[model samples]
Target: MGEELKLLGAWANPFSRRVEIALKIKGVEYEYLDGDIIHNKSALLLEYNPVHKKMPVLVHNGKPIAESLMILEYIDETWKDNPILPRDPYKRAMARFWAKFLDEKCVPALWKYCWSLGEEQENAYEEACGVLKILEGELEDKKFFGGNNLGFVDITANSVGLWIVVIQEAGGFNILTPDKFPRLCKWAEEFRSCPVVKENLPPRDRLYALFKARFEKISGSKDAELASRH
Candidate 1:
């Protein structure tokens, strides 16, 4: 019997995009279910991921795997032809460690910096920059986070490479600049230009419009709040 594979994802979500890129790299054939998570999440997404009800849920042979990083690890283990995680034991562990760091620390800081208001936003920017600096140092002499190839950590850092650029452009926030993070900027260019990633990314204009509208709403709300306070 053939293996059954399906991926629930949204076009605009970087987390889902990570899974899509990984699957493409491995040459895996799976049904792409547009969860439309921002507007209305699908029933399958809810069924598979009850706790989080989030996207990038990988359903394999009737089994559901939630969380983007976990799904990536699952894909790496299930498909041996094109390895995502490193082969060496220590290297594999380090790859997982860095991926965790990106998910737990970097992603939150970036999101907070982008969406927050006033002093909280300033603090988030500092925290996000600090984490990004750590990532920059981590990339010291390597072409990609996983070394030469777009491996585990590189896939995990998709938000840093792509989404942040779009977010900054849409929201008019200048945080991850070429001058401020030269190496990371270069890495972003390299990552985005890779054929697999380049072809699969959400249209820049679409993402820009989505974030721009959202940022404007937030700004309007903040302005109204401040006006009422006086």
Candidate 2:
């Protein structure tokens, strides 16, 4: 064998899903270690990503790469068969730009949804919507951000949708209502419905229970709905 490839990730993370999707699209076989670091982090996580110590660390041939975006580029370059990003220098740079926008602007709100219910929570919700709205504008007549197919930006931006329903229920907020953002709503539907992504999604009930419990902990008896579960 050439070398063993491994991925350390948590189930609910969109960041982690980026790496997972890239691997699948590339047809790269790898071992997945899904242990949430929010509660219990694995030694592999610490050893692989010492600095930020975040999840979705890809270990290739014993060398580790931290940060999901970096890993996305590495995956694209390493396995060039099913191209995710554009080949042209300018187009590739543009894809990176949009990916950066999604990573920075939209990803955090999903995690922060729970434990926030006041003005701060409200602001977070709006900003999150605003981020998606920007993308909607950019995708005016395009099927995918990559133009014809699901490209790097599509996978990266769509990662956050994994826990959207859970985050909404846990945080007691709704930003991407099916009625409000039709384009985005449709895009989310298409994104998840895709074979590669649909295959790897976590169970809804499991994520709901997990997020609800975590939400209860953070807000501390503030959420009446979760209290009903008790």
TM-score top scorer: 1
RMSD (Cα, Å) for all candidates, in order, is 1.2, 3.8
- C-alpha local distance difference test of each model: 0.91, 0.79
Task: Tell me, by lDDT, which candidate is best.
Answer: 1
Question: Would you list the clashing residue pairs of candidate 2?
Answer: none
Error of 1 at 198 (Å): 0.9
Give per-candidate clash totals.
0, 0
Model 1, CA-based lDDT? 0.91
TM-scores for all predictions = 0.96, 0.88
Q: What stretches of model 1 exceed 4 Å from their correct place?
A: none
Q: Pairing residues by index, what is the TM-score of model 2?
A: 0.88
Error of 1 at 106 (Å): 0.5
Mind giving the per-residue lDDT tens digits that candidate 1 earns over 110-177?
A: 99999987798987878999999999999997889888988999989999888999999998879999
